[model samples]
Target: MKASATIAVARCGERDVVIDQRCSAPFSVRQCDGRILLASSAAAPVGGDELELTVDVGAGALVSVGSVAASMVWPGVGGESSSMTTTCAVGDAAHLDLSLEPTISLARSRHRTTTLVRLGSDATCRVLEETVLGRRDEVSGRLDLSLRVERDGRPILHHDERFGPDVPGAWSSVSVGAGRHVVSAVLVGIDPGPPEVCVEADRSAAWLPVAADAAVAMAVGPDRPSTMNMLAALHPALVRTAPVSKPRA
Candidate 1:
């Protein structure tokens, strides 16, 4: 089955957040503490499914989006594949946070995902993407992931990666080393930072400046907990510590 979900949010006042419009099936959106939570419903997606999502953050609004649970990718019975695409727009002085859950690819399964973000000159945004190869002692199927962000119509960040059986040594390559999972995080409109690498207990993570005001972090680990710990260690450096304030009148 194929599925799609869309969500739009805007600031009503100094601290009021509102949902402009939403459309979804097999996925549901809930609002809590000015953040939007997405979850799969009874008609959750399975093999051969396609999902799409669009998010719009109005001027002066502050919004965060996250999933309730990890999405499981199962192999198609007849050799089909699944795909997901997301598009986001952030207005002037707005803030958008995308803290998506991990994607677990089962044996022989195939999945693809793409995300595009457009931001205003003064907008602030943070994004996270994670993928786990497979269950215990199993090799993952395949995955193609891409993310792009542009501000004022100029490209600010672009990342694309492919992993799976089709790619030679996809799992055991130098890139992954001893890690079975990978996580990436990006921060825009932040202060510049020097490139550096940090290692902890069989995990390796790196942070590099992508633009004058943007940076990207990548980590690889043997399992979810370690990889996530690496991500947590790098978050404070990329994300702003101060709260988002309303745009000036």
Candidate 2:
């Protein structure tokens, strides 16, 4: 199945409002608590499925986008790979934050995801992404990820990576090592100044400056929590809301 979604936000007086929104099955979008949320209506992006999302932020507007839950990829009947692409446009003086839950690639499944960001003069944005190899005690399937960012038609960053048992060089000591989860973040509005690198027994992280006002941070670890923790320490989000921990029974 194929699904497409679009969202447009514009600044009106003192507040930013959603001017337009279009949703399809398995891709539901809604506004809540002054932000936009993407929710899955059904099991989606199964092998052979294609999904696309587009976002536009009007000049001077400040907006944020997030997902409700993690996405799961399953094998398709024809064994073809599932793919998802996201395109975003930020207008002059506008700001956007795209932070979504992790995506899990199940055993025997194949998936690919790509994100492209275009910014006008003085526009800024923050994007966060997370991925998990597979469920606990199960082998992971093949997965590919790509990210591209441009400001005023000038390239700012272009990165790509592949993972899984089938991908050669992914398991080497110099590659992912014993990592099964990854987290990456990009900040395009502020200058991180310098580069920083950290390595531990189960994880490694790096913060690299890319442009005068942009930087990228990445981390890989044995699990999701460690990876996210590492990236959080390197490139802290402007506004982050952590999940509430349950009390012991």
Candidate 3:
């Protein structure tokens, strides 16, 4: 199956959120106040599924986006692979909160994902990405993930990761370790606080300052619940309570 989804939000006179434009196929989008929820209406992604998504935040707009449930990538059939690409643009002083559900890669599956974000000078953003290697007692398939972020036309972050079969020594890499689940969060245009690290029974989490206005948090856990707990503990340190106001030109 192939699908595409798009959403654009603009700020009205004062605090109203205007959905300038929206389109979706196979994937459904619902708007509530300033928050948007996405759900898949079509069958779960299989071997050769493809998906595309785009989001735009108009100047001064505040919006949050989330998914209803986790996505599962089943093994490819007939050597077909799956892929997804997403792009986002945040206008000046706009605030975007993207809390995506986890993705599980089943055995023998092959999938690729890419994300690109462009932010205005004063824009603020919070993004989360999580992945689970495989189901109980099963080895994961293959996955290639890439993320890029730009601020005022200049690059701020560029990251790429590959996991699963075919990548030599990938399973034992220090970055991923032997954990079953991994979660990463990025915060932009937010004040940085002191760095903190926490270790629990089945998870390890850390909040690191990337820059004065940027921060990143990551967690690796034996299971989904433990990983989510770690993420919750680190969220307050990375997420800003209020959006930053745009400055006069």
Candidate 4:
């Protein structure tokens, strides 16, 4: 299923905002917590399900995009799989925050997610992500995640994580989920809150709350040697733009 949402800031006055929005088939939204929740449900198949979601926030706007409920990845029907691709755009000094809830993959169901972000040099954006391998019961299978960041059409950073059956206690390990439902957040732009605040969150992961001259990125999951190295080698500019230094716990 393909779905899109666009918000344009006409004016910002006194903590009030004016927005313009549009959506396509299989994508819908509901109001909650002074924000809008976007959602999509698609037909599942064996190879998997594919959901492409896009959002654009015009200049000088503050917007947040998230789901009303935890996203689900069902087992592929007839040998099919499921995946999602999300793209976001943020303009100058504009704040676009996507506070995503947890994503769960059922037994035998394989899933992947790719996020692409584009932002103006002065734009500020904060992204959040959480993927939980199995819920209360029926645990198994691998979940792959891929992320890419770009600015001015140039690739910045990329990450991929895979978790599942072959892994030992795959979903509960410190390198994987740390026995807790994992959650991740990325904040970028000229002014990204205070340094202390970012450090607190990064302590939850590894490197974080860094500066980005133009862009920033991150990825998490059961480690695959190549994937982690590749994410680190994403681009010198990307790593330099955002200083993500980590002190081993």
Candidate 5:
């Protein structure tokens, strides 16, 4: 029962879009101004859920992170198991896009996510992640995931995934989020220019911020496809939500 939240968002957009933020939580955290809205799905809380978050972006402020639902990680029916943690800080010519979506671990869940970024040497960032696996829909059990990413403090990227089935690489096809279900990654900010940014960094779905900076980990299973490219799997608050998704109902 260690719930937590700390947010500091200030860009107040004209084009810099941070929208708005100011939150402190013990429980009861539903946000506005772009989003952060998830109050729990299956609804049951006596003393087994934990959420910790800390976000700060000020120096050239620009932040966009939206999520209010699609956070389902439940699995502790008297055997006890529940957890969550997130951290972020961005300054220096600041611009941050943290839209970490898709997290579902029904059944018997245990989740962990840790991220740290401190770049003052021309600071700029783009961090997007995704994870989905819990039996396409017809619930089962077992889910464990851990992730960490850091820069300037070094720890480029770290990983873990265990959706069960003896969990030893959980069915390795040569690494990371193996046997897939749907796992994604993207990390940017690095453009020292020259030679068309190293030939557009060999064209691995270009998410051009300055030049070409990349970190792409892929997993999809069944012949393991998804070499990630749709403009380097574009993330920057998903290009501002693709122009408001004006499709039909």
Candidate 6:
């Protein structure tokens, strides 16, 4: 199956308003409490499925986006792989906050995700991605993720990562080591001051500046709570108030 969703928000006189919202099967969009919320109406991205979402913010507009629940990737028939792509564009002087819930990779499943962000001059944005290896007591499947950000037609960041039994060096000391959960985030138009690093027996996290007004943070831990805790310590504003809820059916 293939599906796509889109949303566009712009400043309307005195406040930000949704100018366009289109949803397809397995992808639902809603406006609530001054924020745009995304909800999956059906199981999706199973092996052989393709999905995509696009968000647009008009100049001078401020928009916040969140997900209603965590997404679970179920193994596709014959263990085929699936993919999802997210694209975001922020206009000059606009700000976009994308705080979606984590995605869980179930055993035998293979999934890939690509995120691309384009920013106009002076535009600001925050994007976060989190992953749980698998359900409790189960080995994780495979996941490949990539992120790219460009500001004013200039590239500022490009990152790629993969994890799972099939990924080379996924469990090596240079990677997550023995961790099962991972978090990655990027912030533009905000100076997080200086780099911060924290290392512990079972968990580690760091926030590093990548550009004049951009920063990236990464973390890994034995479990979800510990991993998110490490991220929250570095950028409290990016961490959600509540943890990602259990995966939907």
lDDT of 4 by residue, 1-249 (tens): 434555444324434243555666456665556565776644332234566767666666666667777776778666466777788877766666676667776788877777877877666666656676677655745677776665556655566667777665564433454332444445565443322211122222233435544334344433223323433343332222221211110
Query: TM-score for every candidate vs. truth?
Result: 0.89, 0.93, 0.88, 0.67, 0.32, 0.92
- What are the clashing pairs of model 3? none
Q: Rate the local accuracy (lDDT) of all candidates.
A: 0.77, 0.83, 0.77, 0.55, 0.49, 0.83
Question: Per-residue lDDT of 1-249 in model 3, one digit per residue for the tens?
Answer: 888888887777665354654556668887643467778876556789898879888898877777888888887668578987889999998888877788888899898888888999799788778889898988888988887778898876777888886787776645577788987777887776878798766578888878789877878888988777777777574433443332111
Off by over 4 Å in 1: 199-201, 238-249
Candidate 3 Cα errors over 4 Å, as ranges: 199-202, 238-249
> What lDDT tens digits, residue by residue, belong to model 2 across residues 33-93?
6567899998988999999999998898887888889999898888899998999999999
Error of 3 at 209 (Å): 1.1
Can you give the lDDT of residue 179 in candidate 5?
33
lDDT per residue for candidate 6 within 136-204, as digits (tens), equals 888788888898889988887788888788787768777788777888888887767889999998889
Clashing pairs in 6: none
Residues 1-249 of candidate 1 have per-residue lDDT tens digits of 766677776777666355654656778887654457788875334568888888888887877877888888887788788888889999998888887788887788888888898999799788878888887898887888898889999987788888776786665644576677888877887784677788866788888788888888888898888777776676575443434543221
RMSD of each: 3.2, 5.1, 4.0, 10.0, 14.8, 4.5
Instruction: lDDT for model 6, please.
Output: 0.83
- lDDT for each residue of candidate 5 in 1-249, tens digit (9 for 90 to 100): 666656565544433443344444443445455454434434432226766766776666656554655566666657466666667777676656666546665555555545555544355666565655564643324555566555456555566555655565554443333333454454555442322111122122322332255454433432212423333344433233422211110
The residue-level lDDT of candidate 6 at 178 comes to 77
Residue ranges of candidate 2 with Cα displaced over 4 Å? 238-249
Give me the displacement of residue 152 in model 3, in angstroms: 1.0
Candidate 3 to truth, TM: 0.88
RMSD in Å for model 5: 14.8
Rank list by TM-score: 2, 6, 1, 3, 4, 5
